[model samples]
Target: MKNMSLVIGLIAGMLFGGGLAYSGMADPARVRGFLDIFGHWDPTLAFVMFGALLPMAGAWQIQKLMKRPFADVQFSLPDTKKIDRKLVIGAILFGAGWGISGLCPGPGFAGIALNPAPALTFVAALLLGMVAHKFST
Candidate 1:
């Protein structure tokens, strides 16, 4: 079962990576271009997001009929999920980094696999931050 779980995770990651590659989303520069408000803002990312979300929305509707939850895991539906101060602060930090570097965790990790130069540095910094957070918190 553990092996199966690992296999499933691997397969999911592969599929996600492939899809991102196909959609040109794995490149964070594309994401930064999309997020650019004052400059040239590309809408392809938004359209792609909607295309992906449409099917997921349908699947969510179908999920209501399932007798048991997927993987038999308890899924707690969040109640009153409102944006708070933490969310705003995090968003500011995230937006600032994204705008400056055009890199996030997903593409940073993927770029490491693809042997990109700058992404390697970003991944190293990200890992260090994660480790530091673990000890600090």
Candidate 2:
């Protein structure tokens, strides 16, 4: 079971990496270009979002149709659907980080995992930020 899980994870990672490469999303330069709204205002990232979201929505719908829960484990989704204060604040923070850095957590780590210098620095800083948050809390 463990080996199967490792294999599945590896396969998933490879496909995800290939998708990033195909979409030109693994490059920080392209991400930066997308962030430069005042200068070039590239819509490439918007297309990327649409491309990613379409398949994701389909997968969610398919999963919903399944009678048996995932891996026979109880299906647990989010408890709250309300747009509360924390949700708003978290959204604002997420937007600000993406706006400033042009890379969210997944792509940021993917970039670093693929061996980019800028990605390494950003990921290191991100880890430090996480540690700081942990200690402060």
Candidate 3:
């Protein structure tokens, strides 16, 4: 059962990676172009985001209907309703990084298959950031 679960996860990851690649999300230039609102802006990423949201909104509705997920593990949903200082700060940091590098976590991971050096560097920095968060918290 564990192996089957792993296989399913692998397949899902592959599909996600492929989607990122095909949608041009994995390309830093495309991502930067989308982020560049003032100069040489690209609106294509908006479609990719909309395409992603459809499935996610459906899943959210399905999750609300389900008493328990198909998985045996307990549901661990976010309960926060208020935006506080930490949330704002985190958002600022994340946005700044994304604006600067044009590589968020998903794209960074998917990029490993396309280009190893920069992707690995990004992953290392990401891991370090996680560790820093762990220590700070």
Candidate 4:
């Protein structure tokens, strides 16, 4: 069971990384272009976002019918529905970082394979931020 879980995780990660690469999301310049709404704004990433929603919507529907996940005892879904200051603040920080660096957690990690220099720098900063948050909270 553990081995199967590991295999599934590996495959999923590979697929996710491949998708990011194929969709040009792994490129910081491309992401920045998409984020830029006024100057030379690229609308290509919108398709990627819409494409992602389709699979996720289906997954949520499937999850509703399943008692338990195939590789897990429980669904391990987020139970929180309340929005608070922390959530709002975190979202602001996330948006700021994404705008500044054109890299979020997933792309930051995936970017390493495409361009290690900036990606490594982004990953290092990301890790530092995580550690700081852990200590502060």
> Which stretches in model 3 have alpha-carbon errors above 4 Å?
1-5
Poorly placed runs, candidate 4 (over 4 Å): none
TM-score of 3: 0.91
Candidate that scores best on TM-score:
4
* Local accuracy by lDDT, each model: 0.76, 0.76, 0.88, 0.92
Provide the clashing-pair count of each candidate structure: 0, 0, 0, 0
Cα lDDT tens digits, model 1, 1-137, are 55666776789888877877788776777888898868988778887789889888997887777764554354445786799986798689767876676777776777776658888888887788779768975
lDDT score for candidate 1 against the true structure: 0.76
Cα error, candidate 3, residue 23 (Å): 0.8
TM-score per candidate = 0.77, 0.76, 0.91, 0.96
- TM-score result, candidate 4: 0.96
Candidate 4, 16-124: lDDT as tens digits: 9999998898888988999999899999989999999999999999999999988878878889988999999999999999999999988999988889999999999
Candidate 1's TM-score: 0.77
lDDT of 3 by residue, 1-137 (tens): 55766876789899999999988899888989999899999999999998889899999999999886565355569887899999999999988888888899999998889988888898898899999999998
Off by over 4 Å in 1: 67-73, 76-82
**Candidate with the larger TM-score of 1 and 3:** 3
Query: How accurate locally is residue 12 in candidate 4, as Cα lDDT from 0 to 100?
Result: 95
Cα RMSD of all models vs. native, in order, equals 2.7, 2.7, 1.6, 0.9
Among all candidates shown, the one with the greatest lDDT? 4
